[model samples]
Target: MYDEFTIAAYERNGFAVIPALFSAEELEEIERQLEAHLRLDLASAPKGDVVFEADSERSLRCLFRIHERSVFFDQLMRDSRLIQLVRQLFNGADVIADGTMLIDKAPLTTYEFPWHQDNAYQFWNPPDAVAVTLALDDSTAESGAIVCLAGSHRESILPHQPSGVFGASRSLVTPPNADEYPPVTLSLKPGDVSLHHVSTIHRTGPNHTSKHRRNLGFAYHTSRSVCDNAAADQYKRDLEKFLQTQ
Candidate 1:
């Protein structure tokens, strides 16, 4: 459950870290489920939905549309506690999940996620959206944990350019005064979670340590936030093209 201070921190800083969102045993079961999914042939996965890090066949870069692929992920998205958090964040408004992703940052790999805002990629009309990343492994700065610019969501969405990585976008570190905003690294243990607004500027470095970093991320949008259908469709086409080349 979200306390008043937690909600206020999220409102003021555009993000908050919640410890023990899941228990250790629950995390173990989730990892087991994910490993079962991973054992399947890549060709069996929906095209353009799963991605890998460059030249690393075993390094899962991202898995999109996870709720559609697995009942476990779908249940996670619909959990009562998660629903309550979403409603609380959005002032009791109805919430719907727009996307879910599983990201893996392989150990000792250079897989940097460029700084960008979530809404910049989708460009929702009212931009009322939230994202949560639940750490499946102990995430540290050395293992590519996410770092966000505190309170950056208060500013308008910044310009983003295609980063040549499928479905990935990058932003300049100048406009929001990245130096002034001060980055907050979200170091989380297994079952810990971090939540951020749609327009929060965030990124992570490569995993330089020996431990693999894995997280399940979900994006939720309030009923009041509407996506630009045309842009969304066009993005899908572009994403398809990019994935085909990978």
Candidate 2:
């Protein structure tokens, strides 16, 4: 559905931004549904699905498996705009929704996400999944916007270790030297979306602005892709042990 230039940018830079992908009305509806979910449904959400700020239990860090919990989010994952883009990204192959999550970076409460790649946690065999992040609020440098290392997805998965952060559990074993890999801050406005490869190296700083930085992440993989169950299970066990000690 996207032009070659747009697709090419994603391939070249490991990430691409689609400006104003969602209309203001759609965003308003999204906010309304999200508010209802938080107020009425969040209390019953499964453990581990909801994560709070490390130091403040009242401050939310993320809400995972949103599509499974909210009908509005389930339908959102099936939207043609998102599905078509994912298909194009996978060379027209049919895809399946991996999961959806809402990341809320509360001002002065959220911790910085260390540099790492998504595949480190997912362990997808083909490593072709794409993460679609829909900006619910303006993301700027001061708001700890996502920053990606250009072309890093072209490399194999890097080593990762426990980060000790609540929501973000793993981090790159060796942080990327900015001189060797220049970072590109993916600043976006409300209604904008960004797509990134599973192997892309990315991280976010803690929000410094008074405003919150919130985004909805929808991940998808080709129908043929499979997860490395053994590795994934091992990672979970390791993460559990790491968290227990904290």
Candidate 3:
């Protein structure tokens, strides 16, 4: 469903936005399913799957692997529209859905996410994964929209350290200081979808507006790609150790 220009933009900038990919009715159903999941499924969710705001008792920060807990989300992972887009991004190669998550930023209480590459957390060999984020609410600069460094995917994975942010634990050790790579703020409306490469350098600011910033993310990798098991295990150990101090 993507045009040549859009594919070229993704290749050149390491990210691209597709406007109004989902209809309003579809979004309504998605919202209903999300609410149901929160009410009926969250209580029994696995440990570390549901994370609350660090300072607030009731505010949620993120829900990891939602596709495994919610049927609608599970089906969404295999939807033709998303599958076709991901396949095209992978140059017609088949892909496997890696994971899904719901990220929520409560109004005025959320913290900023530090700059980092997605592959640092995933540890995928060759790092060919792509993340597709669907905005449930308008994402503006005032609402802490994602900001990406254009063309930064060409760089190798940089050093990362614990960010101390509960939901997002890792951050870049030395963020790029050069001015040549400009930051592109991705301002999106509801029903909009944005895709970015695994190695793209990006971060989001804290929500300053009264409105909540919520988005659903689906990750996919080429079928030929595999996880670096040793590295992934080591990172998990390090992350667990880091979390113990918090």
Q: Order of candidates by lDDT, top first? A: 2, 3, 1
Model 1 misplacement above 4 A: 170-176, 244-246
Could you estimate the TM-score for every candidate?
0.93, 0.95, 0.96
Worst 10 residues of 3 by lDDT: 47-56
lDDT of 2 by residue, 146-196 (tens): 999998898789899887677887899998877766799999999999999
Clashing pairs in 1: none
- How well is each residue in 127-155 modelled by candidate 3, as lDDT tens digits? 78899999999999999888989999888
CA lDDT of 86 in candidate 2? 89
Q: Best candidate, lDDT-wise?
A: 2
In candidate 2, position 130 carries an lDDT of 90
Clashes of each: 0, 0, 0
Assess candidate 2 and give its TM-score to the true structure. Answer: 0.95
Ranking by TM-score: 3, 2, 1
Shift in Å, residue 101, candidate 3:
0.5
* Global Cα lDDT for candidate 3: 0.87
lDDT of all predictions, in order shown?
0.82, 0.88, 0.87
- Tens-digit lDDT track for model 1 on 39-154? 76355778677777667365677788888877888888777777788789889989987666888887887867888898876777787899989999889999999989998988
